[model samples]
Target: MSTQVCIIGAGPSGLLLGQLLHDAGIDAIILERATLEHVLERVRAGVLEQGTVELLERAGVGERMHAEGLVHEGFAITREDEVHHIDLSSLTEGKTVMVYGQTEVTHDLVERRAQTGALSHYQVEAVDPQDFDTDHPHVTCRIGGENIRINCRFIAGCDGFHGASRRAVPESAIRTFEKIYPFGWLGILADVPPASDELIYASHSRGFALCSMRSHSRSRYYIQCNAGDSIEAWSDDQFWDELRRRLPAEMAEAVTTGPSFEKSIAPLRSFVAEPMRFGSLFLVGDAAHIVPPTGAKGLNLAASDVHYLFEGLRAHFLEREDTLLDAYSQRALARAWRAVRFSWWMTTMLHRFPDNAPFENRILETELAYTLESQAAKTALAENYVGLPY
Candidate 1:
C-alpha cells in the first residue's frame, strides 16, 4: 500500500492526526494491535485543556463534546478540612477546562474516520517501521496471518511508550529522562452523583485524593495507594472508606458511594524523550512523553504534540513549506517540558512521600499554603492548568 502518511496505533493521538491529515486531502492509514472494542473499553483521564477542545472542533468532532462535556471555571484544593478554590476563568481572563472523557473523544474520531472512508486495520501484529531515517520510509506488519508492507513519505509513531515506534529509534539517537513516584492512584468509576459541583484535589496526612466526574450522574474518584497495591486487595467498601477519609468532613459526608463499576491502580511517572522527530518518523503523545496525572496534563500534552505535528504536516503539504516540519520537535518539547514541570510540582506538593522527613513535610505544607493564600500563585496554577499556548 502507498500513502502520504502511515500512522501506527488507532488511539486518540493517531486517530486525531489521521483525521486532520485526511481533511487536508492527505492520505493516511492507521494500524492498531487491538480491536475497536478493546480500544473503547480502556479508561483514561477526562480533563481537557482549552487548546484540546479547540483542536477537536477543528477536526469536526467537537459537537458531541460541547453538548455533553462539563465546563469548569474553578477547582478546589483542600488541605485537611479546608477547601481553597482556584478561579481559572477569572485568573485567565475567561479560560476554562472541559471535563470530557478521552474515550468519547476517541469514539468521535473513529466514527468520523469511518464516515470519511479512511483506512484503519485493527488487531495487527508485529508492526514495525522500517527505514524511517532515509528518504523513503515504510511500515511492515502482520494482519490476518499475512505480512503487509506500507510505503509512505512520513511515518507517525503514535503507538505509545511500549509500542514499536520508540524502540525503532537507535538508543544513541534519543535521550530519555524518567522519574517514577513511590505511590499509585487507586481509582474507581461509579454511577452516582459527584460529591461536589467541581473537582476537588485534596492533600491529607494520610495521602492525596481527587474527586472528579464524567457527568452529573457519574463520578470518578481516586486516592493515593502503595505502588505495589493491586485491585484484588481493595474491595468496594474499603476503597470508598479510604477515599472518604482523605476528603474534608463536609465533602466526605456529601459523597454518594455505591458498587463501583470499574477499579484499578495507576502508577504515576514523568518521562520524556528528546527530539520527538527522528528523520521521517515523528512521535506523538505517549510515544514521546508522559506526565503525572496530578495536573491533568497527560492527554493535554498529547493534544499539543498532535497540534504541532499537524501544523507541520499541513504546512509541508498545503503550503509547500518545510520550516514548521524542521522545527516540530523543538516547538513541541518546549511546551511539553513546562507541563512536565507543572505535573511534577503538583505531584510533589500533593502526594505524601513514603518516608517524608519532617522538614520536607513542612516545605510541602508551606508551598500549598502559599498557593492558596496568594493571588499570583493561583494565577500561575490557573494558567498552567488551562494549558500553555500551543
Candidate 2:
C-alpha cells in the first residue's frame, strides 16, 4: 500500500494528526499495536489548556468537550491550613482551562475518525518504520498473521514512550535527559461530588495532595506516596483518610468518601528526548517528552506537539514548502522545555522531599508562601498553569 503519510499508534496524538491531515485532503493511515478497547480504557490527565481546546475545535471534535467539560477560571493552592486562589482568567487575560478527561477526548476523536472513514488498523504487531532518513519511507508490520508493507512520503511516530517509533532510531542519534522523583502519586477515581468547586493543590507537613474531578459527580484524588509503594497496601478508606490529612480541615470535612472505581500509583518523572524530529519519522507526544502530572501538561503537551507537527505537515504537502517542516523540532522543543521546567518546579514546591536539608525545607515553604502572597509570582504560576502560547 502507498500513502502520503503512515502514522504509528492510535492514541490521541496519532488520531488527531490523522484527522487534521484528512481534513486537509491529505492521505494518512494509523497503526496501533493495542486493541481499540485498550486505548479507550486508559485513564489519563483531565485538564485542558486554552490552546488544546482551540485545537480540538479546529479538528471538529470540540462540540462534546465544550458541552460537557467544566470551565475553571481558577484553582486553589493550599499551604498547611491556608487556601489561596489563583485566578487563571484575570492573570492570563481572560484565559481559562477546561476540565475534561483524556479518555473522553480520545473517544470523540475515535468516533469522528470512524465517521470520516479514516483508516486505522488496531491490534497489529511488530510494527516498524524504515527508511525515514531517505525521501521515501515505508512501514512494515504483522497484521492478522500476515506481513504487510506500506510505502509513504513520511512517517509519524506517536506510539508513546515504549513505542517502536523511537526505538527505531539509533541511541547515538538521540540525547535523553531524565529525572526520577523519590515519590509517586496514589490516585483514585470515585463516584462522588468534588471536595471543592475547583481543583486544589495542597502542600502539608505530611505530603502533597490534589483534589481534581472528571465531572461534577466523578472525583479524581491523589496523594504523594513512596516511589515503591504498592496499590495493594492502600484501601479505599485508607486513601481517603490520608488525603484528608493533607488537605485543609474545612475541605477535608467536605470530602465525600466512597468505594473507588479505579486506583493506581504513578511514579513521577521528567523526561525529554531532544530533537523531536528524527528525519521523516517525527516523534509526537509521549514519544518525545514526559512531565510530572503536577502541572497537568502531559496531554496538553501532546496536543501542542500535534499542533506544530500538523502545521509542518500541512506546509510540506499543500504549499510544497519545507520551512515549517524543518523547524518542527526547534519549535516544539522550545515550548516542551518550558513545560518541563514548570512541572519540575511545581512538583518540588508541592511535595515533601525525603532528602531535603533543614534549609531546603525552609526554602520550599517560603516558595509556596511567596507564590501565594505576591501578585507577580501568582501571575507567573497562572500563566504556566493555563499554558504558554503555542
Candidate 3:
C-alpha cells in the first residue's frame, strides 16, 4: 500500500488528523491494534476547548456535538462547605467549554470516515513504523495472518505513550519528563441527573472530588483514592456515600445516585516528551504528552497537537511549503507545556498529598483560598480552564 501519511492509531488524534488531511485531498491510512468496538468502549474526559470544537467543525463532524453537547460557561469549586463559582464566559470574554464525551466524538469521526471511504485497518498486530528518519518511510504490520507494508512520505505516531511509535525512537534522541502522583481517581458513570448545572470541583480534608456530567440525564463523578484502589473494592452504595461526604451540603443533597454502569480507577500523572517530531515521524496527543486531568487539559492538548500537525501537513501538501512541517514540534511543545503547568498546578492545589508536611498542606490551602478569593486569580483560572489560544 502507498499513501502520503500513515497514521499508527485510530483514536481521536489519528482520526482527526486523517479527516483533516483527507478533506484537503491528501491520502492517509490509519492502523489500529484493537477493534472498533474496543475503541469506543474506553471512557475518557469530555471537556472541549474552543480550538478543539473548531477543529471538529472543520472536519465536518461537529453537527452532533453542537446539537447534543452541553455548553458550560461557569463551574464551581468547593472548599469544605463553601462553594466558589468561576465564570468562564465573563472572565474570558465569552469563551466557553463544551461537554461532549470522547466516545461520541470518536463515533462521529469514525462514521464520517466510513462514509468518505477512508482506509482504516483495525485489529492489526505488531504494527511498526520503519525508516522514519530516512527520506522514504514505511509502516509494517500483521493483519489477520497477512503481512502488510504501507509506504508513505510521513508517519504520524499517534499510537499513544504505550504504543510502538514512541518506543521506536532511540532513548538518546528524545528526552522525557514524568511525575506519577500517589493517588488515583475512582470514577463512576450513572444514569441520573447531574448534581449541578455545571461541574463542581471539591477539595476536602479527606481528598478531592469532581461532580461532572455527560448530558442532562447522565452523570459522571470521581473521588480521589489510593493509587492501588480497585473497582472491586467499591460498591455502588459505598461509592455514592464517599462522594456525598466530599461534596458541599447543598450539592450532596441535590446529587441523584443510582446503580453505576461503569466504574474504574485511573492513576494520575504528568508526562511530556520533548521535540514531538523525529524525522519523518511526528508524535501527537498522548503519544507525545500527558496531563493529570485536574484542569481537563489531556484531550484539549491532544486536539492542539492535531491542529499543529494538520496545519503543517496541509501546508506541505497544499501550498508546497515546508516551514510549518519543519516547525511542528516546537510549536506544539510550546502550547503543550503551558497546559502541563496548568494541570499540575490544579492537581497540586486540589489534591491532598499522602505524606504532605504541615507547611506544605498549609501552603496548598492558602493557594486555593487565594485563588477563590481574588478576582485576578479566578480570572486566570477561568481562562486556562476554558483553554489557552492555539
Candidate 4:
C-alpha cells in the first residue's frame, strides 16, 4: 500500500491529524496496535484549551463537544482551609476552557474518520517505520496472519511514550529529560453531583486534592498519594473520607459520596524528548513529550502538535512549500516547553513533597499565597490555565 502519510496509533492525535489531512484531500493511513473499543475505553483528562477546541471545530467534530462539554470560566484553589477562585474569563479577557473527556474526543474523531471512509487498521502488530532518514519512507506491520508494508511520503508517530516510533530512534541521536514526582494521584470516577460548580484544587497539610467533574452528575476526584501506593489499598469509603479531609470544609460538605466506578493511581512525571522531527518522521503528542496532569496539558499539547504538523503538511501538499515542515520540531517544542514549565510549577505548588526541607515547603506556601493575592500573578495563572496562544 502507498499513501501520502502513515500515522501510527489511533489515539486522538493520530485521528485528528488524519481527519485534517482528509479534509485537505490528502491521502493518509492510520495504524493502531489496540482495538477501537480499547482506544475509546481508556480514561483521560477532560480539559480543553482554546486552541484544541478550535482545532476540533476545524476537523468538523466539535458539535458533540460544544453540546455536552462543560464550559469552565474559572477554577478554585485552596491553601489549607482558605478557598480562592481564579476567574479565567475576567483575567484572560473572556477566554475559557471546555471540560470534555479525552475519550469522548477520540470517539468523535474515530467516528468522523470512519464516516469519511479513510484507511485505518486497528489491532495491528509489530508496527515499525523504516528509513525515515532518507527520502523514501515506509512502514511495516502485521495484520492478523498477514504481513503488511506501506510506502508513504512521511510517517507520524503518535503511538505514545512506549510505542515503537520513539523506540525506533537511535538513543545516541535523541536526548530525554525527566523528573518523577515523589507522589502519585489516586483518582476515582463516581456517579454523583460535583462538590462545586467548578473544579477545586486544594493544598492541605495532608496532601493535594482535586474535585473535578465529568458532567453535572458525574464527579471525578483525586488525592495525592505516595508514589508506590496501590489502588487496592484504598476502599471507596476511605478514598472519599481522605478527599474530604483535604478539601475546605464547605466544599467537603458539598461532596455527595457514591460507589466509585473506576479507580487508579498514576505517578506524576515531566518528560520531554527534544527536536520532535527525525527526517521524514515526525513525533506527535506523547511520542515527543509528557507533562504531569496538574496543568492538564497532556492532550492539549498533542492537539497543538497536530495543529503545527497539519499546517506544515497542508502547506507542503497544497502550496509546495517545506518551510513549515522543516520548522515543525522547533515550533512544536517552543510551545511544549512552556506547558511543561507550567505543569511543573503547578505540581510543585499544590502537592506535598515527602522529603522537602522546611524552607522549601515554606517557599511553596508563599508561592501559593502570592499567586492568590496578587492580581498580576492571578492573571498570569489564568492566562496559562486558559492556554497560551497557538
TM-score against truth, every candidate: 0.99, 0.99, 0.99, 0.99
Predicted candidate 4 versus true structure: per-residue lDDT over 1-390, tens digit per residue: 999999999999999999999999999999999998999999999999999999999999999999999999999999889999999999999999999999899999999998999989999999989999998899999998699999999999999999999999889889999998999999999999999989999999999999999899999999999998898999999999999999888888999999999999988999999779998999999999999999999999999999999999999999999999999999999999999999999999989999999999999999999999999999999988889987
**On a 0 to 100 scale, what is the lDDT of residue 308 in model 4?**
94
lDDT tens digits, residue span 14-126, model 1:
99999999998999999999999999887899999999999999999999999999999999999999989999999999999999998899999999999999999999999
lDDT of 2 by residue, 1-390 (tens): 889999999999999999999999999999999999999999999999999999899889999999999999999998989989999999999999999999999999999999999999999999999989888789999998899999998899999999999999989999999999999999999999999989999999999999999999999999999999999999999999999999999999999999999999999999999888878899999999999999999999999999999999999999999998999999999999999999999999999999999999999999988999999999999999999998
Kindly report which residue stretches of model 3 are placed more than 4 angstroms away from their true locations once superposed.
Answer: none
State in Å the error of residue 109, model 2: 0.3
Which runs in model 1 stand beyond 4 Å of their true positions? none
Q: List pairs with backbone clashes in candidate 1.
A: none
The residue ranges of model 2 lying beyond 4 angstroms of the native Cα positions read: none
What would the per-residue lDDT of candidate 3 be over residues 1-390, giving only the tens digit for each residue?
899999999999999999999999999999999999999887999999998999999999999999999999999999999999999999999999999999999999999999999999999999989999999899999988899998999999989889999999999999999999999999999999999999999999989999999999999999999999899999999999999999989899999989999999999999999889999999999999999989999889999999999999999999999998999999999999999999999999999999999999999999999999999999999989999998
Model 4, position 21: C-alpha lDDT score: 99
Ten contiguous residues with the weakest lDDT in model 4? 381-390
